[model samples]
Target: MAAFRDPLAGFVPDALVLVALDNALSRGWPDAAVSDLTRDILHASGIADGTVPAPAFAALLGDGRADLVARVRFLRMALGDLALGFDALTGDLPTFMDRAQTFGLFRYDKAMSDTAAARAEVRPWVDYVSALTRLEAAHLVPRLPGNAGPDWLEIGGNSGAFAAAICAARADVRITVSDLPAVCGLGQEMQKGQDRIRFQPRDARKSGWAAELGARDLLLFKSVLHDWPDHHARAFLTEAVACLEPGGRIVICERGPFAAGLADASFLSRLANAVFAPFYRDPSVYEGWLRAAGFAPTRQTVQLDMPFHVIEAVRA
Candidate 1:
């Protein structure tokens, strides 16, 4: 027999967590005494089983994670203060969505859907891709092992910025970023000054894609797999297995699966994420893919404002 719990009772601690988060914000994240207060918010126990994920919040203390924290801080400001305002709870969402749609969010996606002529100016994915290069890249490079060697390959790398960041960090490492022809052209122009980083036009969707890739010390799939269905992701990993040296590594950097559970005390943030938290995956799911692809995988979740899983698989 189990004791019955109050159905609406969970909101109590949720409310307290909200209070603490609000107080923390007033002092601000970069201000003195914030870290201690943050620790309290993270460790504070509550009745609700679904509190914010602790790892993402705890990650602010780690090295090189500041860039992501800054990005999160800016986003918090961009969303504006929720005080004395109508959240979706008060019927703002219906009207807000209607207005945001008018700004061409759907139109932008529609433009990109055209295979023969995807508009570059609209760049529906610019914010996401920019976060990769500007915010997450610095944090990503440090986690990759030194065995990444001189020859590194990034499959489906857009704009080649991740590879550029790696090359900038490691003078000895040369990298090649492979993507569609259109993206390659843009990447070539954007990455022009970087001597060690180059772009190659390759449609990863085509069969026998890796036959000409040559041997490489490391192959990376940075935030690329989640958009793919499981079968495609598994098939791509199988194809990638043959492209690496015996001791070479395959590093997959992806966002952890999104849960409706609030990661912050803010309901507004959760509401925004409900729109779509692009990185949808479980590290275990990738483990199965790695096993079938002929490598032993090890997983890590690093806090880059939001939690990101770095799965490393070493070739057998």
Candidate 2:
């Protein structure tokens, strides 16, 4: 297994890749068959000479010139790299599996039901990812204008991890995390004793969800908007703008366009795009939506290596 020393592990394969890999396997490909095909492709491509580039590799996988078994093997290796990369960063495969199973992105349901069992299964994964996102938030929150005020509202905030991180950084910052009722309950439970952080049940699509909150100085939508397609995303932004206080800010942090770094795109990156094309969008699309919502882009940071973008916009 390759070892990654960076705290964030540079890049882990997107969860979407794992979903595609699992789907292919479930459809009947065997491990031994994939392994044999992988060996054949390596010999045919003359990978030993190291002359084959990423596009060539992508062609081999997608041009239909290669056999189905070979293509499946190629995908498997990419998914394996993601697994190894995540393990290298966190050193906890069992925990990752628990989260992966609960997330169920490959399944038709795509998440557990609202039963107690569902909450129990999903909470740990939410907590784990939230903790990781909190590190990023720590770097980002301080960069916002000091005039933004102490009131913070996080849309789709899960388990209150980001809110907790913000409150920890500045004790007076009050945080309200809006999410589904089950998720809100889990966050409320996790944030007990931290009176500054609160979770409210909300569905972002429902009209007036943001209106219920009155006005907030800073609204956060971390890894949230990308889950929806354009029309819904635009509507959410409009609602978010209405929720903001005059001169308030809305911060969006999400996975940016997959093709931006295609010159050196890893197998995982390509597979992520294949699986999540509908959910991913270029940052310019976000800029347009912000302007449409009557907000002006104030700051934008694209972390090309880590492959995420943070766009901060303020009400005009």
Q: Supply every candidate's count of residue pairs whose N, Cα or C atoms clash at under 3 angstroms.
A: 0, 0
- Model 1 Cα lDDT, one tens digit per residue, 170-228: 89999889876666666777688989888777767666756777778888999788767
> What is candidate 2's lDDT per residue for 1-316, written digit by digit as tens?
1221222112224444334433434444322233444333433433211222235433433533223333343445445544554553246544554454222422313122455765665554465455446446655556555667889899888888778877887866898998776677777777889899987777777889555877898888887787776888888888888888778898888767656656655554464333333366777889888987777886555443235667889867
Error of 1 at 125 (Å): 2.2
- lDDT assessment of candidate 1: 0.61
Q: Which stretches of candidate 1 lie over 4 Å from their true place?
A: 1-128, 265-273
Shift of residue 101 alpha carbon in model 1, Å:
6.5
TM-score attained by model 1 = 0.62
Q: What is the lDDT of residue 313 in candidate 1?
A: 93
